[model samples]
Target: MSKNKIITVQNVTVTISSEELDDYICITDIAGVKSDQSRSADIIRNWLRNRSTLEYLSVWEQLYNPKFKVFESEHFKKQAGLLTFTPSVSEWIEQTGAVGLYVKRGRFGGTYAHKDIAFEFASAISPTFKLYLIKEFQRLKEEENSKERLEWTAKRFLSKNNYLIQTDAVKNYLIPKSNYKDNLEWLAYAKEADILNVALFGFTAKAWRDANPEMAGKSNVRDFATVNELTVLSNLETHNAQMIREGRDKKERFTILKDIAEYQLDILNEAEKIKIEEKEETEETV
Candidate 1:
């Protein structure tokens, strides 16, 4: 998942900043859902002043955050639930070196917390709300994973068909004209196939195998191609077949096919970025 993955929990639109380490939920959005958007900061401070809240935060930081300032966390705990003990998200982060909470500024400004911390905060607001939040968040992740699988499968099918077409071209053109014995003519077909493979992947089949012996044993280089690479490869395969039928030599075809692969990959990659960015923008408004 991308960093900007958002999931709507009940009436709350929680943005999940999915990073390699952990997913952070927008605490401000969760606060807004429980009370009001304008009062989110005040609500957060109110929660922070509670003794239980500070204890929970301290335990969490101790467990998950190596750099957390346990001494300062103890100091904060000492003053918890006082008449003027309210703390902001920024204070928590600055004082305790807490990574569990974050306060972002600007148009989309808000406090965000790691999923574990956010869910705890939600429980303070309402237990039922936290349960619903968990459900929707799980559903959102499953849906995103499914969408990725579908796209990959679609690209795989197209590239597989393109590979088939290239094989037909090899049989029709290279096999008939080879000077090698009938059984040995298969080598010529393989050589011709590698021309397109090299043009798109930058490695001949044997070179790729030597470089990635374990992976190559189970899957070819094409199996691990990105969507953009696969899209360009499908097109390259079809074009290489046409060039082969025209009796182009490997040297000339490789030059032309390589250029096509580079150009199409660039175009397709840029288009894909634009498509994803537009979708993110639309989701923000909704």
Candidate 2:
């Protein structure tokens, strides 16, 4: 089930459900702010019947939803504002291939729309309510962004620390063995980094960029790695450094590093599973 959050705008509580791409706010709850809870459906229907509302919604669908049926939307647009014409959430969805609005039916059921559409609906209900809704939504996003930055910083610190360990080993062990000129010694360090990347991530740094040209503008592949992958990469860095000091061949080191990466990831995943199961059991008991 998707996690749900409640945000109060001008003393009226509205529910927002999270999904993969965007948050969906309960439009019916917003409707209740202008009318009684019993009249939410009536108010929504009346709003949907307005020609202006249909035009605005059609523009939104065209901009975001590629599969939006232009023919069907045009048909609805012409029928709008007629005395006999009335529209409902389900009827609109039936005509248009829009994932923008969802009619959830259960204990916490309501007419939910994507944040973009919901904010527009809020503006129609009351400008004051719309302002507060945007304010609360921004507050939620800022909190989430802050938390994510802190986690990324922590993992990056771990990766950098292991990098220092690896570099020190290169200076003490690999440099003397290779007997390379001062200007060419940096190549060995770059080669050592690739060894770890290939062993753990199955791609060299250059190879990753070649495959993801769009992402290359913003970051390298490691920057988008999962927490588990970062952890394994950090471990591999230290282990590769030690292996270098022991004078292991590249083929032998790659084989050992790959096995270690797999083993450590399995262990980490198992531990995470146990923690989740324990938390769920506690919640059920409570």
Candidate 3:
């Protein structure tokens, strides 16, 4: 058998009863073992002979099974409560368009029907058992949802943390050495900062200006960036300046930039948990 994707709703052991029929069958989790080795034919035959059960089954078939033969169902209904009524799942399905009826043969066999049909069949087992199946299924879903939320939260927080680290690095290095002779020297410093801006935002100050000619005078990128990205930018500015003073090789600078990018990616992933905790606290207060 292929690996079964077990679905637990309430507490039901949901599995494909038969892939050929595409049936979703639910059984009680507490049921010791499911076996059809016994003399089940007689028991099954007797169950099908019941008048009320026959009516219910036929009604269900008519509702869901478009191929059900009303003519055969009429014949079965007439003999349902009569003197002697013998019925088999195969016989019923063959005669009428019944979605379910247990069978003993065939490859994609051993009782199979659609999910809705299977849920209805579960009633034949026990009502409380069906409820348990649903409950367990719901619990599984909630757990999966929680896991996904946590992952997203962690990524955001990591991004925020790395941003702060980079910012602090900048404050230590670049901010202390501000001196200029003319507007051009100041422009050079501004241009250097724009390298960090380009790596992060894909735009330089001058490019932003040319694009938005009307709003050319103001700083556009600073306002739009997240707190974390800005922090990283500051750190980069300071580090780059320090490296320039030491006359570091181009290869060394490039290597540092690569490391910083990887570090930022790692922190973004880590930030998810922090984000989730904060959200939970806010929710509790609200």
Candidate 4:
């Protein structure tokens, strides 16, 4: 990856920008890896000069898309080796009704093609580079997974903190007293636990407990949450507690926690936005 970790593949950034796709394909680095280039334009031009390259692109388009235009393709065939050759990924795409090559510009711009076309483009660039890109891409995925796991774990820890709060309350107010044997102390302990539960889970553990009271003593709310949800709740509780200690207003804490939860959930839900964008790009170029 370059300092900016941005590569110009076929004159576009290695990353695909969502704004560019509309009746055109964008090419992306197959691996989301980036590199600096000394005259990337020259590298692209050389690929265009290779007749086999054109045929490969043509075949890719034909196999994946039925509406590809042969008329423009024929023109490229005639002009392939001439000194005046000026075909570009974009030009080829436009002329041949391609759905696979995207010519994009600006920040986060890239020639992001579908993975199929992107791999072909990468192979054309440098087989070794393509291999490196794939390796790096796999590494990126692993890193992402690791980050998500760590986040989830952190969330579970936060949830446990809530349980700890309830336990501490029990020790302080419910235990070591004659009331330990009284239903009143038990009710008070349950009430405070319910508050922490509602704060973290948007409902009381007792609500869950009441709904399935049979499972109450054996399991708690956090234990049942999907890792992603637990992580978000944990984050929320930690932040909310900080706000409380800091004397921040309750209104501000609620809003901020809501934003945090929603943002994380969005990332979880749309983890494949980049991949999906690339896939759509390939379809256009094809």
Candidate 5:
């Protein structure tokens, strides 16, 4: 379940619910600020009757919601700005299959809208209120991003530590058995690490260096990895270390790690696709 956050603007408390990368703000709370709480739904209905609002909503749905009912939206478009064209948020959602706005029940219940739509709704309240809403929402997002950066740095550190564990396994189990001088021990470690590099990234450290010579001196492939890649890399390192202790050959370990990398990365990538979709939606809004 998504958690709800509260942000106050102009002394009115608004609830924000995060679903993956999309943020839904409580438009009902925003409406309450303009008038009384009981009239929030009426204010939203009046806003929905505007022709420009209908056009904007239709464009947004077309860009992001493949299943959006274009025919139904067109029906609404023709009636927009007409005195008889009053539409509720729930009615609009049900008719157009709109994903931008929704009504929740029970705890934290209200009419919630995507940040893009909520900002537009705030404009109807007043330009000043809209600006304040944007400012507070941006502040909340900045705080979240700061926490995420810290967490990512901690994960990267853990990945590096796990990498050391893998290298130590290579030094103890593989180095002594092979004919490698003390001066060449680092080569053995590098080669073992390459197995993981290739499994997760489809390239070795040297291959990455050769491809990007400018960055080679300053950073390696791991430095360019995404949070998801780093997470899988850490797991691959731990698994490779255990496999090394079990006397598994490089070829077998590589195959196993490759399979694990593909599986884990696929799941993580799927989970993160929402963020990418949200970015595209934001770009379209811009």
Candidate 6:
């Protein structure tokens, strides 16, 4: 579990955890919608004891969990649907090594099931509730994806603005100092821009276009860059401009900018990893 997000279906607030790439929905909360809060555990256990539920769980575990205990699952399958065969979430995990469901304890504590299983479990609550849950979940994911695209667009805009700063430095400081004629001065700006491109992306604009001819007219390399790459590119543009002002040669500036790009990208990647780990820990405690 990472951070917890919520969706309300028929006034029932259900918690969701985006665990890695999969979404885990709080089945305990779903149970509350079917019965009183105190009977949620019993409701879940009753569902778990159903033979059809056991068959579905066994198939899911076999498909996704290499470490799943098949023999233990078989033992449970034989007992499923019996009056004395109630199983708790923790017991199932311990015996079968299942990853489809997990019991988290704390303020937001509950049994969370992977979206596939949660949707199945929701049917046991009510077909109407299950349909609403699926609809709301899809809406939440689409909203998140849209937000991510918006952030990427904002970063791309920032990178373009910084590129203008870099070009201005070349026009004011580097071009006039060179022997280029009036009409050919544009080459100096192009060369300076390529220096940063080579340092960060290991290719010139023309080289990238030649390599991806299909995307040449529609988008450049920067348009396809990751958020971290765009961030480092933005920084490199500023640094390259300052270097040009200091009268650094193209070769020397490229070398320094490449080193900075590598170092900053490494730091940013590691920071992102740490942030995810910290979020998971915080969610577990909560």
Which predicted model would earn the best TM-score? 5
- Regarding lDDT, does 2 or 5 come out ahead? 5
lDDT of 1 by residue, 20-133 (tens): 346788888888876789998999999998889889988988876777899988888889878878788888899889888887777556888888888999998889989999
TM-scores vs. true structure, each candidate: 0.54, 0.58, 0.38, 0.40, 0.61, 0.59
Q: In model 2, which residue pairs have backbone atoms overlapping below 3 Å?
A: none
Candidate 3 residues lying further than 4 Å off, grouped into runs, are 1-3, 7-14, 17-23, 26-42, 101-109, 137-286
Ranking by lDDT: 5, 6, 2, 1, 4, 3
Candidate 4 lDDT over 130-198, as tens digits, reads 666556555655776799788777767866565455655442432122322122223334443343444
Candidate 6, overall lDDT?
A: 0.81
lDDT to native, each model: 0.76, 0.77, 0.54, 0.57, 0.81, 0.81
After superposition, candidate 4 runs with Cα above 4 Å error: 1-38, 142-286
TM-score of 6: 0.59
lDDT: which is higher, 3 or 6?
6
In candidate 6 the C-alpha lDDT for residue 232 amounts to: 91
Q: Hey, what RMSD does candidate 6 come out at?
A: 20.1
Winner on TM-score between 3 and 6 is: 6
Residues 57-146 of candidate 6 have per-residue lDDT tens digits of 999988777678999998888998788899998999999999999999997789999999999999999999999999999999999989
> Weakest 10 consecutive residues, lDDT, candidate 1?
174-183
Every model: Cα RMSD to truth? 19.5, 18.9, 22.0, 20.6, 17.8, 20.1
Please provide, for model 3 over 19-57, each residue's C-alpha lDDT reduced to its tens digit, 9 standing for 90 to 100.
333434423222212223254345445556777667777
Ten residues in sequence with the least summed lDDT for candidate 4: 16-25
